[model samples]
Target chain A: MNTLIFRTIAPFLAALMLVFSVFVLLRGHNEPGGGFIGGLIAASAFAIQGLAQGVSAVRRALKMDPLGIAAIGLLLSALAGFLPFLGAMPFMTGLWIDLNLVADTVPVSSVMLFDIGVYLVVAGTVTAIALALEEKETD
Target chain B: MASTAAVSPALLEQAMSIAPVPPEHWLIVAPVLVPLAGGAALIALRHRPGAGRALVGRLSILLLALTLAANIGLFLMVVEKGALTMVMGRWLPPFGIAFTADRLGAAFSLSAAAIALLAAIFTRGEAGTGAPAYGPEPFHLLLLAGVSGAFLTGDIFNLYVWFEVLLIASFGLLALGPDRAELDGALKYGFLNLAGTTLFLVAVGLVYGVTGTLNMADLAMRLPAMEGVPAVTLAALFLFAFSMKAAAFPVQFWLPAAYHTPRASTAALFAALLTKVGVYAMLRVLVMLMPAPLEELSLLIAAIAAATMLFGGLGVLAERDLRRLPGFVLISGIGTMLAGIALHSPGGATGAIFYGLQSMALMLALYLALFEAARLAGTPDLMKGGGLYARHPLFSGLVLALFFAAAGLPPFSGFWPKALIVKAALDIGAWWLAGAVLLSGFFLTVGLARAYMLAFWHPQRPPAPVGRGPQTGQAALSARPQKLALTTILPLAVAALAVIGFGLFPERLLQLSGDAASGLADPAAYVGSVFPGAKP
Candidate 1:
């Protein structure tokens, strides 16, 4: 499982998957992909890196504890739900803001923020579990 | 296109009927959201050096206090305004997730929050300064959130989600200890509860398939009118699933086996709140949502209730472990509440709700008392322990009061609910149910008296040299008296006061319980609250 070819390609594969995950997360507002699926993809990427470079390397790369990341994601999602309170609206109400860029308009919404939070939560939790399992294997 | 046209008029009417929510309505959700947000924040701070156990415990206490206040406010508002409903994201009923608070939900949520706050304070005395990576505070808050959500949610599917939330948190709390017994207990608890909730989910799916709505109020309205929908079978499935969760009758094996394995604070919280939530769900569904099926199945439920009462009482008498005794007491109390449900009258429902509330506080206090008693004696074994009153008279008195309450003796909180239930049973000509209730109470008293005599009154005897091991001798010798902490004493005192207060002057609770029962017996206001202009 730890062959030279596999080890060499894993980092690049993980990087590509992480990028693809973000793409899926961003496009989820009006498309087939969303935070849950994106998070799964990112979690798989972390698992791949853990398998290739070891759990310690992945932990060091993340710089934050995976559970901390999950916690922050939960906070972000909850805050997103609270955003409508400023406008005297009920909880979890979506408020959209369209950004006028140099060449195009990009629409951002609290719903999108919520999706990103969900993605981070899923990715972080899965990575934490996977890393723990992998470390147990090494032990 | 034809279908769209066909649905457009009703959709438009529903959309137009959506009213702007008042600012005060947020209180209904605050009990749930505050804990979730606080829990997440606590977890986020888990790795920080400054976030020690003391800090986390204080934060948890503050958070739970806030939730309890919110619940009280919500309860008051519901009492004043009748049932209150808040649909998420301004969606109409039958499509949106609804948080509806009637007398029963509001009162139960208030009790849940109060018990949670007390449990949080109890944990402060037990928590050490060294903080684990995942402390119990966050999970505690998350568990409260789940419970409050379960109590308040009007959507059946949302209730399932809340159950899962609490179940996950409970599993985390159950396995937090390093002992193998904790893990073993958690496995059994987790497996049985998961099976219960899975059945519940399947039933919910079938309900939606049949009735085409997950909103409880809408189901209540539609279920009776719908013909050839197997409503009785669906009701039976619901009762079976909830009965499993409630640890009633034959399905109750998991509770006593697992509840005693957790640390005392966690165990007390579970004893106080978990099965009560199951009972609350049962009452809400069977009584309010599907009355016809409940009437049809009253006999079966009564049989189950009687068996649960007898078995739980007998288990209490035969149990040796002090920690496990409270679990059986809890099960026995649940049986009494089920008898109330079986009576299927407003009086019966009132008795059930009142008994449930009393049991929640009593069970929490009882478990905490047992934990302290075990610590004082240096062992949890009933036969090996004695002479608690000789050392801590005040504490022993408190434990006695809680036991009397558990036994449904006179001049305690437990007596009033028993009287209410027995009277309701007699009124309905359920002589056997009334007999079961009285007989179970007697059994419980005897069981508890034997426990109290062995653990608190009887003189501590020297260990027998021949059969008793040296470890037992050492344990008895090493029983150094420890001073009870103020944090521990305060919660126990508050619980005792509540039991006595409610016992002496039960008129208020009786009236509140009666209102809750009436609301269940006729859910016109409950449905009307959810859909403002909908016909009952």
Candidate 2:
């Protein structure tokens, strides 16, 4: 049955979401992937968890509150945007400090940090909403 | 470590001479904080009996008061300064996150906050006794955050986030209500809005690709500077997204279906506040950001606006459901605002802002009145409710006042803004638009009259033992004004007084909206503040 396939494939899909979400979030600064897409992927993973299991089971497993995570993510993302200002750059202007790494120079900017903030937001918001609706239906 | 982006310390210091970022702009943070923290606190105290309601009520009131104070303070400050723009981080204008509070955004956000404040009071305890009331507290907070985000966000992509935030909150509110009507309406409303939001996201993505920047004021400057298909495509996307919100033309069926589904007071807030926020966004972007494309697409937009106004009014007239009538009326009013923009004059645009406020106030009052009438009649059917003056003189009288105010009779808050818009149309040689406004006004009059007749003038059918029905037409008026507590009455009173106050002194808000309009027209001040080194 389709439900069986969905169940069997869900864990793999969730694992893929975790990997892709992080990959997208990391590459957002100069590449195609970013916070929003990454967040969607994570939320999809939670949704699959709900679909594969049940709302109560998934809520117990997650433990953390998703909406709270979203709020914090927004705050963190906003904080990331404010980082460039200490140096008198504009809001959200990227700041890169070259670090000596294993082979070559590594650059980390505030925008990358901001992207992570967004990824957290997306994951938190979507998952929270999905879980709430699922729980409501069960009741 | 506190980085320049922590708060616009310098700007805040210069403006207020206080701790930077003025509490108002920072007040934007409260919605994000309160409910989330409150939700946690609630979860922690779930074992406690009779505790959550008091806590939630206190928190909701406290935060709403703070939001009110922020808006009032921000308005006073902006009035003193002529214009206000704050970039989130020290990031420059074109690239950084910017939040601007021109008079229009400030005023409307203030209006919406006022509506939510009263609505919160009316619905606060209605969620039913004990922990985990009706809709979740976190849900309400997100709704507040979403509205604040829309009002403050300066970029197109950011607007999408706000819309998503609003949608999610709305869905939660709708679904949590849990009734057949609410569920059916919620499913339709949710799916439609979700689809619209997805389209909006795609549009925002396309806009970023085309402009390489997402800040709205930045887009306003750069978009006009760009040319051809990409610009047109972005314009199309923006139109599609905003139109979905405005509920104009063919896309508006869901509003009528859903606006009446919630509890009457809840419906009042939705009818008054939510969709206008969309109209507000359209007013901001269409006029400021993509004016050139606006010109190219003016006729198309104008045609749609005309269709929205006329057709929506027809639907209102045809609808027998009193609750459903206001939904259509609100859409038609949006059509008028759109028409003003299409006329493309400062006067027209200014009228649009004022009329937008009028429509919201009128719709809220009307819904409040209609809800009472429905309760008295034991159903929402307009035909079922009649001859109530003897039974409830206070309710009947207030409903009549609300009807006139909504109908745009003179000496009420609703008339001035509309008169201004009509005057603007005449000034701009928009005879057709002017005519449509008048024609729509005529039809709206008839629609309200129908309610007046059904509820007040017509005889109520006689009750067998319980109440009356077909042809028995006698009435028992409730002796007093329906018992709206002080908090409930306060918003309605404030709104009614505004209608009267503005009717007397149209110039008070008029000058403010006009100043905001002028500030919007010149991109230099906004750009100069954000990107100090930009080519402006």
Candidate 3:
């Protein structure tokens, strides 16, 4: 499957795809983008690499296991719920921060961060579990 | 611990004084944190595979043991201290995390914890052999997280979040046993329940819109002050949402189709807790927090409850699959409990509480017993068993007792709760309703008897015996003992004893639940328990 042209291009493209997925995840809270879409993009990147090289190749490329990513994302989201507890508020009340940027207000919040964590989790968990099951079917 | 998380003065003022702040809330909370922390630690230590899995298992067992012990401790504390409530982070009443420990909550928690503990033990036993390897601790941890979250969360929105927690964890559990049939169940379970959850979320949003506060105590406080437009709408949303969760009437197909596929222990655990969480939330928010909703649409709910009971009981009678029968019976019992709740009188409501507790314990006990019998008898095919009463006498005896408990036979806890529900309904001038409630018990008993007759006494056409017939055990290849290990034996024993003991000793539970019902009826008591300094 790894023809000469595909072999050279796959890694570069997958890495680019993953980085772009993070961008979507980070921007999810304010704009239309977020973790779910981001995770799907990242998974797509691995799929592309899988197509060009092999399943094992994609699995190796993503070192952090998908299940772990999903779990951490879940924890990060839950921790977001607990953030208020730390700030002497009730559980799950949203917290915000603002940075005086050159053009925009550049608002940031723990919720948005939590979404990013969710994004990584969704991306990692779905892809890993799906791919792992597919490999099992083959066996 | 005193740095910044003090309960605000204004919030305390809102919670009028009467109830003592329940210290036992920490006992429940500690078991919950252990798994949450363990999940985090396991992820951090993922590089050490052996250590991680071992830690997860050991910690889960240890945590479950501790939680069981915690329930025991909390039970003692409840007897000593009355109902209990805990406010997380010491925020003011409306702004903090509230966890309560009334007798009702303790009863449910103790039952659920017992189920989880048994499931943990069974999983451990299965792990050593060639059976399906249990999923990582995070899965069970997430499962427990959902259970604890459901048990402890005091607000509506937080309940939604806990629903999501369990939803995600359920995805893992469903997928862990992935196959064509399992996936079929998973997809249906996910889509349907997610819809129920989303419906609940919408209601919470609407309740917040109407009440402007998500806190149960705050809602109770504001409910009296608020006007109509959205209150009825909020109530409607709550009914629709909780009905779906409890699998009331029309929305229950997802349960029977999906539940039988999981590993037996997992199925039993889900059987014990999932729908009850819905009941608990409904009891918390609708009955206690906003009394008007419980009274207003109760007749409609009663009708739905009646339908749920009849359909479920009949559904169980029709099923030949042994595992599937109990699933239907479990669904049927939901209707019975709802009937108790629907009578809309205090007596009726308390009856619902007792029956709800009794049935949950009995249904779980039934599943464990049935699973054992099915494995021993093999084929679980109702048509093919004969004289097993002579072969597996002890197992048969347990099955008979569980059937009696499930059927509400006298001297069993199930009977008293069943009797109370009827009495409660009758006290409310709903003689017809009382009759239906009584009939539900009798109907379920009929199904139980049918299953018993077919399972042990019915003579097979071929007259199969040990020497002449086909295989009649879990493994057709061999007559494996289908070992009833300590884990299996212990939880079942506890449930049986609870059924018999709680049945005869109804007065204690009644007294306990009366204090709880009083505390729950007055939301102020719940609020005051969390903030002892608050005055009426």
lDDT of 1 by residue, B1-536 (tens): 11234666667556533445677888888889999889888887877786766677788889999999999999999999999987776666788788899999999999999999998898877743223665688889989999999999999999999999999889989988776777889999999999999999999999999889999999878888989998889889999999999999989999999998776789999999999999999999988988999999999999999999999899989998888899989999999999999999878899999999988889889999997787777667788878888988999999999999999998999999889889989997899999999999999999999999999998876644454553332343235457799989999899889998889899999999999999998899999998777886
Q: Residue-pair clashes per candidate, as listed?
A: 0, 25, 5
Listed per model, the TM-scores of chain A against the true chain A are 0.98, 0.87, 0.80
Q: Report lDDT (Cα) of residue B455, candidate 3.
A: 81
Worst 10 residues of 3 chain A by lDDT: A84-93
DockQ, per model, reads 0.55, 0.16, 0.15
Docking tier of model 2: it is incorrect
Q: Which CAPRI category fits model 3?
A: incorrect
Higher lDDT: candidate 1 or 2? 1
TM-score of 2: 0.78
Instruction: Show pairs that collide, candidate 1.
Output: none
RMSD of model 1, in Å?
3.1
User: Over the stretch B1-536, how does candidate 3's per-residue lDDT look in tens digits?
Assistant: 12113867565545422233344345645445545645554554554446555566677777677667777777677667765665654444576667666666666677666767766665654432212234544566667667676766667687788888877777777766635666787898888988998989888888877667787766666685666646666776887788787888888989998887666666777787788887777777778776776788888888888888888878867888777778887887788778877876667667777777776677777777776666656556678644557667776787788777777788777777667778888777888777776676777888888888988776543433555543222244125454566766777777777777887888987776566666667766656665555543
Error of 2 at B208 (Å): 2.6
> What tens-digit string does per-residue lDDT give for candidate 2 at B1-536?
21445766676444322224543444333333333343334433332456555675667666666666666776676576544666654444566566776667777777666666666666653423222644445455557667766876676777788888778778877776646777888888887788777887887788777678888777767778776547666677777777878788878888988888776566777777778877788777777777777878877887888888887778768988776877877888878888877767787778778777766667776776676576566456777657677676766777777766666677776667667778887886777877777787778779888878886777875534454433111222232233445655566666666666766777877887677666666666656545545665
In terms of lDDT, model 2 sits at 0.69
